[model samples]
Target: MLRIPAVIAVLGLSALTLAACASSPSSAASTSCERTDSDASVLDFAQASGDFGKPAVTLKAPVYVDSTTYTDTEVGTGRQITSDAQDVVFSIAIANGATGQSLVQAAPPVQPLSSWNSSYQGLVTAMMCATEGTRVVAAIPASELSAAGAQDLGVTDDQSIAVTIDITKVYLAAADGTPQYNDRRGMPSVVLAPGGRPGVIVPDAAAPTELAVEVLKKGDGETIGQGDTARVQYTGVNWSTRKVTDSTWENGASVAVAPGSKLAFAPQLVGATVGSQLLVVVPAGASGAGGDAATVYVVDVLGIDDPAATN
Candidate 1:
């Protein structure tokens, strides 16, 4: 969630060799179930050039997009981790001989860089605590599909991905002595104190809730303009009864809150200032709640990724 204007995306565009390898029958046969155990030798051989240290910790069966699994190593080191509530974003590279490396799939902290671009911030939390050579794999489900972590996963509805992370180095201070790469830097924080509320948040602190929102992918040199999409996540609950009426956070559910949907609003919704909480009151009759009254939505703008900006 930290906004690092200086964060650079190095063009590490190697041809997608592994994708090509996966399509080869010979390659497939060579790495099948019969070779699962021996495969580690080959995998290790490919990964040998890299001195990725032992995992500080490992997480098995970490779930990603809907049933997708990261049932392998999800390791990290003290250097790979920070004591911040927000996740840490590491400089990742492929292990020496490994064919491909990916970011684990999950919300914020767990998501790999491949799935987490500037516009999206998947789940955020404490990650692996391993040594320098630690290697981890995580599953990334598209936003529409991570049933429990929809908002944090920040994907377009239903896009699934897998990622592996190998921390190359960790930094403690900036040139000015400030911390440099944790995920929470420069991002907004949730205010749970008296009379304070964020514009958008998990509908239920305990349950999953997804709200449809537009992201500001681009801005005209001036300000937010037409054609710019505003990114947001939301949830709805009955105002009077406080019962959840509907949600976009559920897996396989629609991810758009367009004009005809239960939550309707103007097309000019994008470009709204970040952190401006929105309250949408849906009348009871509008949703056939019988005499149950209406529902309300509280929204908060987490971050904005201007699509038109030159990276």
Candidate 2:
């Protein structure tokens, strides 16, 4: 996958590129400030240098799509690529460089997007179509982004952006290049108690302590035996505050944990058993909370077929 530092790399290059353009006396303008027709050499350099531009979205998994127009967004530290819009949803964790003595570490996995209006679809769609290791640019009009997304991106009306996507790796169980599980949408809404999370607790008799779950997606018929790898989509929040400090919502991705690690998922979880729900309290630091405290998780098993995969 494109390394996280790639974002900084692209920004750095952008500065240099701007300086270079500003110094050169081109036909009409001095700076390559606006998106212009890319010549063969510029396109070739983008392909070789792994410079996607802006902030590129690197695909950890192969993205499948019918037809979508995407552009190069940005590059990672290793010069990885990223892309722009499409309606694909999947979650991923991004760790900043210099954490844990590593420049770029694998991030948490996320859930996949299936609905038409899923918040993450546009970004995913743009990344899915990009060639592996090559950065493609997408020019998205400001109106296409959500209000919060637009504001966060500093977007303006009639303004277009350059979204770079680098294909670091594409994982698919079959030759057709599609995920084993299909995306889901419009699930039955579950109301949460005043504590905030999803699903209400029954205070009456037979109040169950165990979690009740609904299976949404099935893995590739592989069994999640001991020592196997698993990716799960989860959300964690303070029981008292109900404020979600961490979530895979933006990417629809999951976290890969070992079955025996402090943050491991039970290895025995597999097959139709893949989507089975397990209710467990988030143990302090495990949920990004430093001390011993209670945290709730609503997890969905996305992949359980690979035992050696890094999330």
- Tell me the TM-score of each prediction against the true structure: 0.30, 0.34
Decoy 1 TM-score against native: 0.30
lDDT of each prediction vs. the true structure? 0.30, 0.34
**Against the true structure, candidate 1 has what lDDT?**
0.30
**What digit string (tens of lDDT, one per residue) describes model 1 on residues 1-311?**
21222112211111112112221111101111110111132222222222343222222222224432322243443333321111123433221111222222211121122222222222111122333334544343454233433333233354543334454433211011111232422222222222122233323322212223332122222222355443333445655555555532221111222222334432324544433444444445544233545545544332233342111
Give Cα distance to truth, residue 281, candidate 2, Å: 9.9
Deviating ranges (above 4 Å) for candidate 1: 1-93, 97-224, 247-262, 265-268, 285-292, 305-311
| Tens-place lDDT digits, model 2, residues 185-235 | 311223422212244232223212232334333333344556666555455
Location of the lowest summed lDDT over 10 successive residues in candidate 2: 23-32
Off by over 4 Å in 2: 1-125, 128-200, 206-223, 235-253, 263-297, 304-311
